[model samples]
Target: MRLILPILFLTILSIKAFSREVASDSLANIARNAMFTDAYIQIEGKLHSKKLKVEVNLGDTPEQTKAGKEYSEKLTGKSHMLLS
Candidate 1:
């Protein structure tokens, strides 16, 4: 029904907004705990380097999961990563 679709959409949007709020807060925590002081990334098949879709997660150094995200984002033109 029409009403069902609108209700579903609203619920999904609210859930997304809430999730983002939570994730950002976690980002602050991660940054504080991150192990890597700083990082740079490389892109595949690109002659010139560019920085995009960039965000640094918190840790003293970059952990595997966080670094993997940065690496995948850099390669978005050629590939993307997803968590399950």
Candidate 2:
């Protein structure tokens, strides 16, 4: 029914917002933990590179695609060393 759709939408939105907040808090904690410093940095770097990869693959925005290609080129030789 119409009421059912609205109720489901609201419930899903609330759960998504709550999870986003929790994930943000967890990321902050991970960044602050000295023991996790290296791991955190590595994970962050990989995430950035992966996002750039998606942009390069899509080639939707000219500016983003160009920047991503340049950035990825710079990482070509270094990624192997760092990721290892």
Candidate 3:
């Protein structure tokens, strides 16, 4: 019984560690993709207004300009939901 208890505890610890590693790897992949993804930017509003709305593409396309206006709008909606 004593031996079983220690083995069980170690097994649980190892499982938790493995899960953490997997989670971290996925997070890293997400970060890497975001960093390399092509992006398009738009600037609106007049300089005199002292404010400008800047937008960028967040899609996985190789060229953001080729993604079309609709693509950006779609991606932006998802991002807005996440921000909210």
Candidate 4:
């Protein structure tokens, strides 16, 4: 019947929307868990107004610094300062 089709369509649409929301929430949780507080990026200067500088201090350890340098270069497109 027409009513049955409409109800089924609405149900399917709602289910799809719910799934998307759940997927987004899970992705957010994953990103939150993966946040690196020790490794960060610092922009020391203004952009277009002054010499824009990017400072990255990955960590105190050498290994951490090395990884931070690589990540910084990748993120900033090889334009910035990486302080160990």
**TM-score of each model, paired residue for residue:** 0.25, 0.26, 0.26, 0.34
lDDT of 3 by residue, 1-84 (tens): 989999999999989888833578888889888855455566555544444454665565555455655554554423222222
| Residue clash pairs of candidate 4 | none
Report how far off residue 70 is in candidate 4 (Å): 0.7
State how far residue 83 of model 3 sits from its true place (Å): 24
Which RMSD does model 2 reach against the true structure? 17.7
Better of 3 and 4 by TM-score: 4
The number of the candidate with the highest TM-score is: 4
Indicate the TM-score of model 2. Answer: 0.26
Q: Residue 62, candidate 3: how far off, in angstroms?
A: 16
- Model 4 residue 16 lDDT score: 87
Q: Give me the runs in candidate 4 sitting further than 4 Å from their true place.
A: 1-37, 48-52, 77-84
Give per-residue CA lDDT, model 4, range 27-79, as digits (tens): 88898889565656776555443354455787888888888787656655333
Window of ten residues with lowest summed lDDT in model 4:
75-84
Candidate 1 Cα lDDT to native: 0.57
Q: What's the count of clashing pairs in each model shown?
A: 12, 0, 0, 0
Candidates ranked by lDDT: 4, 3, 1, 2
For model 1, what is the alpha-carbon lDDT of residue 76?
64
For model 1, residues 1-84, the per-residue Cα lDDT tens digits are: 989999999999989888833578788999899854444443344344343344334334447557767666655654333222
Q: Model 2, 1-84: lDDT tens per residue?
A: 989999999999989888833578778888888442111111234643543221123244676556667655655534334444
- Candidate 2: the clashing residue pairs are none
Per-residue error (Å), model 2, residue 84: 10
